[model samples]
Target chain A: MSEAVDAFNIMVYRQLKRFVRAKSRLFGSIVNPLIWMVFFGLGWSSLFKGSMAKALFGGYSYLDFLAPGVVMMTVFMGGFISGVTVLWDKEFGFLKELLVAPASRTAGMAGRAFGDALVATIQGALILAAIIPLARDINPGGIPVTLAAALLTGFAFTSLGITIALKISSMEGFHIIVNFIMMPLLFLSGAFFPIDPLPEWMKVLAYLNPLTYSVDLARISMLGSGSMNPLIDTVVLAASSLILIGSAALLFREATID
Target chain B: MDAIVAENLTKRFGELVAVDHVSFKVKQGEIFGFLGPNGAGKTTTISMLITLRKPDEGEAWVAGLSVAKKPAEIRRRIGVVFQDPSVDRELTGWENLWIHGVIYGVPKNSLRRRIRSLMEFVDLWEKKDTPVKHYSGGMVRRLEIARALIHEPEILFLDEPTLGLDPQTRAKIWDYIEDIRRREGTTIFLTTHYMDEAERLCDRVAIIDHGRIVALDTPENLIRRLGGDVVYLHSSSDRLEELASMLSETGLASDYKIIDGKLMLSVRDASKAMPEIFEAARKLGVKISEISYKRPSLGDVFLHYTGRSLRDSEGSWKETARIVVRRRR
Candidate 1:
């Protein structure tokens, strides 16, 4: 049992060390969400702050509503990069070394998912802290709940990312997924705008997106106003996190390296 | 007990059989060499032994544990350096070794000292903090060898360990390998196409060709089995067959054949038999324009069994002979 834990810790330590050592990635993760909150949020909040702003934004400014969305988006995008790193490991021949080790592949996969989720959650927390000054009336006590939502969302996406990386053979194919699936999911998940004002068909997609629950849960914690019940959002995000992580582990056990 | 035992192991890809029904055994603490040219099932055989690929037929036992039933146990007891460089280039050398040792369940109390000693043994102690991306090819290979030994496995499998290195560096790697076997008494199984590597490092060699073992024995024994020194005589006229028959009949050469209009002779001692050979050729009216004799090498043994040069095309001996004839014409 200790040896299994050792394997898990070794894998997690590797990812953490590599992630921290990459200075460019650290810089990018900080600057990226700022662009979304400052430029996009400030630009669009003006148009929505008129008489209809209270009704559309649940009695708050556009930046306030968009802050929670941007936090979830930060964690969401960060989780997506876990797959690229796995692909890079495969291409560079490190995956073979890991596969041949006596350690369980399931333990290694869980460690990787958790490590990536940790990094993504840190990035999400950074965005949350950065935007707290720009937006008003954020419940200080709800900060823990917002972070919890970020972590759960990151874990689910990281698992999904690894599963995709295992199934796809090439980085080019992963790029196609980024353009087609990831971007579409991000836009339709109510991260950039309110889902209630959307057409009926789009609302179904918003409801179906796992990110919608994460964004809604974050909104309830940060702003005390959300479209869905907080309990339902929390339950759905936690359950999906468990399911995705379980599937990723199963797929990882069958992963082969050439 | 034998460290490894393979029985009729086979593997196929589509319609092609990569590894045929092959069987061999390696004694404990002995260095065994699997010698073959490229695509001669060398890598495939090693893959099966290392538990990376499942065999299509037959079974293997590594360290007395079945590869089919207990691959995890086999993996725990053995270390492998793949044909391709498998080190993580992004991580520092120290980090790479540390992670590998930890994952392999090297005890935490001794892991640090083990990594340090391994790095120093491979002469990479100063560069341990540097990322592997900055390492030279030979350094990367040395680090890989050291990492494989971190857990002190019972057997070490090296697949073309010194490939693509300069002769000096290759010799250095050889010394390290020999030192490992001497100090730890670990069973070393290595595959290489270089004749000198097998001849110098292995206690026994199995020469594989076309997915089969053409010959298997000690280097000296394999060469001895080829009879003796080889003598090549090129005649000015097409009288090679007459000269071959004359030399064989007169007991000047133990065996003689005609290849490319040259009389090829296998003699016990070429220098002592040269006078007799010249006399026989003269009586047969065969003018020997050029004559050369050299002690048999592993290459000669390989050719005697496989009937083709190791460095040549992948075709069978008959096809190679036909190609040679066509080129001459």
Candidate 2:
């Protein structure tokens, strides 16, 4: 047990050090969501407001509806790119050093996912901090729940990223695969729009996406109103996070080193 | 007890057998070398023994545990430095060593002190705060050696440890390796194609080629197997085979072969054989253009066993082109 803990802590420590050292990555993750909140959220919100927007956003403004989505998007995009670090390690040969250590592969990968998730959640929190003043209707009591949703979203997507990273060898292949999977999932998750107004086929995809549960949960916590019950959103997001984490661990355990 | 043992260990990639049915035992605290040219199964054999790759045909044991059965146990007891550099370039030297110690389960209290002493030992103490990307190649290699010892493993496996380094740095790295074995009593297993490195550092060498070990013995014994000195006789006549037969029949040469249009003779005493060799060449009307003899080297033994010199096997089309371009100039 101590062995696993040691491996896990050290991997987290390593990832954090790498994340902090790259100043641009730190600055960019925070700035990215703010751009979406300002350009996309406010831009679209101005054109669609009052009773029609209130009906669409459950009495909240379009900016308030878009606030939680932007926060979840920050976490989602941050977690999705976590595997690029793993791919770099593989390319630069650091993965061999990690793999040959006495520590379990599952522990190492879990540590990586946890570290990535933590960074992604922090980025989400920063975006929330920025959004709190710009967007009204955020319940101060639901801040904890919003952070929890961010963390869970981070863990799920980071694990998903790592699972894909373990399969793809080259950077080009990783970007191609991740971007291919990411664009559809992001658009289909109803982050940019309401799922209720979507066509049946698009609504089904939104329901099927794990990101949808996270976005819904974030919406419930921040706006105090969402499409699904808060309990259902929480349970689905938690289950998907565990499933993705487990899959990443299993793939890491069977991964071969050269 | 042997620190490591392999019985018919083999690994294949698609149709290519990377490591053949190779077997050897590394005794406790001894420095053993796998000497071979590129793609000669050295790295594959080390990978199998280190538990990175499983043997396809047979099993191996490391630190008394079977590689196939107890790979985790073996990993805990052994340290490896791969041929390619594997350090985290973004991290400081100190951070890299600290992470390595923690991951290896070294007690947190002692890890800092251990990392300090290791850094000092490798002469990287002053540069510990610097990121590895800024480090020289030699400094990174030393840092890796220090990191590998973080666990104080019983056996250390280095696959081409000093490859792509200058002679001075290679020798310096060799000193560090010897010091590790002498001070810590760590059994060292290294692979290299450099004859001088094998002769200087290893107690026993296994000459591997074409996915097999063709010879295994102490450097002296392996060289001694060549019988005596190597006599290089460059004859004016292209019919070197006729001269080889004459020298062999006259008992002037114990063994002879035509290499690069030169009659290479392995003789008991080159001085005694030289006069007789000249007489034989005179009788055949074949004038000896160049006559030189030297003590047999590991390269000669490799040639004697594999029928090819290690140095001569590395000529590529690019190298040939460079030579042709230089001649034109």
Query: lDDT tens string, model 2, A180-253?
Result: 89888888887888888889998888899999988889989888888888899889988998999898899888
Per-residue lDDT of candidate 1, residues A1-258 (tens digit): 887788778877987888887879978987988998999999998788676887888887888989899999999989877745677777777888888888988888878888888889999998888999999978989999999898899889988888877777776777787888789889988888889889999999989889999999999999897999999998999888888888878877776545
DockQ (CA atoms), all models: 0.38, 0.37
Off by over 4 Å in 1: B226-302, B308-329
lDDT of 2 at B2: 90
Instruction: Report per-candidate TM-score of chain A alone.
Output: 0.96, 0.96
Task: Give each model a TM-score.
Answer: 0.86, 0.87
Q: In every candidate, what fraction of the native interface contacts is reproduced? A: 0.63, 0.74
Over the stretch B1-329, how does candidate 2's per-residue lDDT look in tens digits? 99988999888766566678998999999999999877677888988888887789988889999988998888889888989989999999999999888888888889989999989999999999999999999999999999999889999999899999998999999999999998899999999988889989999999988778898999878876778787998976966798898788877678888877787898988888888888888888888889999876656777889898867755532353454345333
Error of 2 at B32 (Å): 0.7
